[model samples]
Target chain A: MVKSIPLTKADVLHLLSEIVDPEIPVVNIQEMGMLRDVLLSGDSCEVLLTPTYNGCPAMGIIEQDILLLLQQHGIPNAKVKLVYAPAWTTDWMSDSTKEKLKHYGIAAPLHSSCVNWLKPDQITVACPNCGSEETLLVSRFGSTACKALYRCNGCKEPFEYFKCH
Target chain B: MTLQEALFNYLLRLGDNALIQGHRLSEWCSKAPVLEEDLALTNMALDQIGAAQAFLKYAGAIENKGRSEDDLAYKRAERQFFNNLMTELPIGDFSFTIAKQLLLSSFEFFLFRGLSQSKDQTIANIAAKTLKEVHYHLAHSRDWCFRLGKGTEVSHEKLQNSVNALWMYTDELFEMGEADEVLMEAGIVFSLKEIKPKWLELVSGILDDANIALPNVDYMQTGSRKGIHTEHLGHLLSEMQFLQRAYPDASW
Candidate 1:
């Protein structure tokens, strides 16, 4: 039987980058900045992940996918740990990912400091579909807690705006 | 309480507050007056449970007893819970529920804002993340309070009575205990005394805008810091803890 070389951390990260986020299939977890760090000892690997929000439902699926991806890539012993310190913010998401989200019909998150809940007029949300500035908030909440429902009059299309934390 | 014990107890109070309030909100799952309201409340409930898990997990780590977040939340007896009595009080009418949230969410917003500066890195980090959510919660509840208070004759009457009834319980949120004293001295926790005035100003301003009178309540309820809660908490725990009790060590 021919033996194969043990995978390195770079190899593992490259392979894991192929796994797309279950919620937003257009962006990989790495591009979303969800993969905090990866540590390898012998053939075993440990991945530290931080969730976008404390209760993001996507975390469980991402953790499972990470483990499965590692296993399929010839690493049998991979552990994924969830950590809360240095809590995640949308700022971690790259500019490229934000553009990808907009192209996929979901508006990217705005800067958190600019959000004033009392004065919706203070914030400007552009519709992802028609790129129009005339968007009304349909609801403070959308399909998920992290998103807000907005409707664009220009295109008459309702879209989910990823809310800033 | 020793400093370590005080820290543990403080964490329990924070965690229990989130857990109990989340459970109360979850009860409106399919029963809300509208579908949007149902989804909104449940979303808030999910955020609270997430906060509860984080605080309780840290508490367990500090205790060094190997108790996970589930063990602390599900296995604890009613008397052992340290959530404010206001949280465990029954969710009465929609008006009452709105009033409850207005008070609780305002309190939480200020509490988390101050706690975000905690000397303990873990607590500060968690508080920073949750503060934004609590801010939105306060906005939602306060907006609804104004609408319900000024809507119609029936709506105004119901909302007025509900806010007045919940006013007395608001004082209990500021009741300090040994745990609070210890944590406050260490800069690991904020002084509830300081947060009270800010909360009162915000509440009073909203009530004024809503054309509702502030109740002159001298008598205040207390005893949550000492693990004393209303009868409603026991029923809530029974329902919440049933699955864990029925199947010990069960995992999916």
Candidate 2:
């Protein structure tokens, strides 16, 4: 075999950072914490992505984007695998992503140890539109599986928020 | 049957329902009336397929079968399927499709809600995850049902006809079999009888909001729980299993 330059996991992660989510274009996979793991052997790369939700529609597009990103960088034998174990949660999102989502007019998830829906005081989701702590959930579900419908008391605009599971 | 066997069969029905319905919806990918609706339909179909994969994987594990989700979905024959008859019906017009979705999602909402409270942790976890998706699907279908039922006269008439034709098949969904009995006894699954009243109430509320009346005809019950499907399933399987049958080991 001709001398093949070895690739590193860091290089693969760098490449995946270029793949932005299709629905939410402001943040790339890395920012959203969607890129779970990357392995590299010689010139081949394997990327792992955790879906936002169990049946997220953006998953297919994200996989394709990762493939294209690697292929463009001359990594011909790249493979993308989806791992569902240790399931993804809003808690995995980075601080930058939280800021970006707020700036993009979507409420970022509230961090809470309690998963109980009956305890409203325990879960406090900040409003993204007007930076208000006074927001109410309009519906438990939103237009998509990953989001919940909410309205801000400050801005009075209904917005979608990624629910913290 | 053991609790494991009952759980496997129950998961199989859930997976089969989603897989068959997803396959049916995918047939309309490029043929939808508008681009947005097309994307929406395909997105919904993909969601169902993903849910099927989760359930099928769980079922395989419960059965101690080394089969993958793809093997369970693609390799199974029509007679081996255990989905309710509502899932396998042809997607006629937009109205008919919406009507089917409304009925199916309403049933699924109750099913998942009940499953979430199961004594089995794995089954409850899967149900909790799937309930979120089914909630959105129910809302989407309910919205469309309202629009179709109360919109233009032609739309109303078409939607009414679809509901009337499909209402007869709704009883099959709540029909319990031996597997259900075993699961219920084991607390691995809830009794469908317990879910039926909620399903009826929610479905009726949607119909009432849409200004559509429930058909007075007696409900039809099919033996899909026993692997007997409607005539449409044969044609559907022919198309769905074509590639797998042609080249057994074909992969891209």
Candidate 3:
């Protein structure tokens, strides 16, 4: 058997960049802000991941992806640790990531989730297809925990909105 | 109660409430009034399940037992559960669910806000994460209270009746025991009584706005402190734990 070559923390982080969100396949986990940090110690490495939503089933798959990637790279004793202190926020997502989501037919979060829940009518998301701000709230829940359903009056298309939080 | 015992019991209460409530909400899947509402209820169910997992996992650790979250969840008996009485009641109807959720979410809003500052790091972390999710549940429930409570006369009457029927269980949500007092002294948890006023104010605001009157409950149901639960819990557990019980240690 060939001897395994160890990967540095940076190398592991780079490899993990390829792991995409299982539900929203358009963007990677890193871009979605679920990949928080990576720490290497001696022969063991730990990846810090913050879940998008505490109940998101994608978290289990993300952890499996991290372990699989590490094993493929011959990294030993690597583990994924979920941290919830500061709590994941939409503010961690960049504008480009938002654009990617929009291009994928899902309207990105309009406001930072840092803002508290406002009245349902106050939240106005632009339709990704028609670029019209005449979208109506369909439901606060969508196909996944991270999305909310919306309907665009301009194009009369129902779309998923990446929920702010 | 010792701090360890108090903390463990407190976590059990939190976990059991979420798990039972989630199970009830999940019963609405594919059965809600509409598709969007169906998805919404199940989404809430998913959030509560996740929160329940965290709390139960921590509780198992606190007990220093070999049991995992699944063990605590699937292997436990009805008498071992510590969920609030309100959480275990049968989902009577859409109006009943909306009324119950309004009360439950409002209480959790204040309860979690207080626990977010917990002296224990694990409890604090779980509370903070769950607090974020609770915001949406609270908002949705509050909005529905208005929709059902102030809609047609039939809708308004249904909601009012649900509130009156569920009023007795509401007090159990705030009832305290030895564990609560101990946790409060240790700073691991704040007094449920401390947040009762806030919980009442929030609930009363929605009820008042929706034209639903404050329920005049003469006496409140109790018993979660002693691991006692409604008979509904036994039946719920029987169905929920059937697979695990029938196929012990079965792996997917």
Overall local distance difference test of candidate 3: 0.88
| Whole-model lDDT per candidate | 0.86, 0.80, 0.88
Which residues of candidate 3, in runs, are more than 4 Å off? Answer: A1-5, A118-121
Query: Per-candidate TM vs. native?
Result: 0.94, 0.74, 0.96
Q: Indicate the docking level reached by candidate 2.
A: incorrect
Measured over the true interface residues after superposition, the C-alpha RMSD of each candidate is: 1.9, 5.2, 1.5
Descending-DockQ candidate ranking: 3, 1, 2
**Tens-digit per-residue lDDT, B5-95, candidate 1:** 9999999999999999999998988998887788788888889999999999999999999999999999999999999999998889888
User: Compared with the true structure, what per-residue lDDT tens digits does model 3 show for residues B1-252?
Assistant: 688888888899999999999999999999999988899999999999999999999999999978898899999999889999899999999999999899998888888888999999998999988987888888888878889988999999999999999999888888889998888888888888888888888889889999999988899889887978778989999999999999998879
Candidate 2 structure quality by residue, lDDT tens digits, A85-130: 4456677787888899889877877664545432333567778877
Best by DockQ: 3
* DockQ-based class of model 1: medium
State fnat for each of the candidate structures: 0.48, 0.21, 0.73
Residue A102 Cα positional deviation in candidate 3, in Å, after optimal superposition:
1.0
DockQ of candidates 1 onward, in order?
Answer: 0.54, 0.20, 0.70
Global fold similarity of model 3 (TM-score): 0.96
Error of 2 at B5 (Å): 3.0
